[model samples]
Target: MALLLKEFSPAELDRIIEMAWEDRTPFEAIRHQFGLTEESVKATMKAQLKFSSYKRWRQRVEHCRTKHLKKRDDSITRFRCSRQRAISGNRISKR
Candidate 1:
């Protein structure tokens, strides 16, 4: 996992964490963007978050239909909100 940590910059990791926490961002999306599998993302979240928070996150994600591509609706193609502010040069701006 240290090797995986080395692969991402602090900003990238932050982005990954943010994405992981989003209800619509599936594990496959994280895998596609960062090469981290669902398990890896879970591990990273566990390592980064407090134990209770991690437990709550796990409970929330465990059965969330939107967190897995296979379980998500076919019509949903994008993970982010259409009204979401743009991200530029690693900085996410509010609308």
Candidate 2:
């Protein structure tokens, strides 16, 4: 997992971290975009975040039903918010 994570640019890593933190962004979406499994995403978060932050993130993820595709509502189809504009150059456009 470390080697796989190494291939990402700093910006990509940041985006992965951001997506992991989003309640509605499932692990499948991260895997689709970054080729990381749920375990690998957890590893990336553990490696990149402080211990306290990692713990909090884990707790939050465990409680967030939307973070896992199977647990998410079928009505919610997209990985991102409907209000969010297209991403350009790795940056999500500001409203």
Pairs clashing within candidate 1: none
Q: Estimate the TM-score of every prediction.
A: 0.84, 0.86
The per-model lDDT (C-alpha) reads 0.86, 0.89
The true-versus-predicted C-alpha distance at residue 28 of model 1, in Å, is 0.9
Candidate 1: C-alpha lDDT: 0.86
Q: How far out, in Å, is residue 77 in model 2?
A: 2.2
Q: For every candidate structure, what is the RMSD over all alpha carbons to the true structure, in angstroms? A: 2.6, 2.4
Compute the lDDT of residue 44 as modeled in candidate 2. 94
Tens-digit lDDT string for candidate 2 (1-95): 66867799999999999999999889998888888899999999999999999999999999999999898889988777877677754567776
Candidate 1 wrong stretches, greater than 4 Å: 86-95
Task: Quote model 2's TM-score.
Answer: 0.86
Counting clashing residue pairs in each candidate, in order, gives 0, 0
Best-performing candidate as measured by TM-score:
2
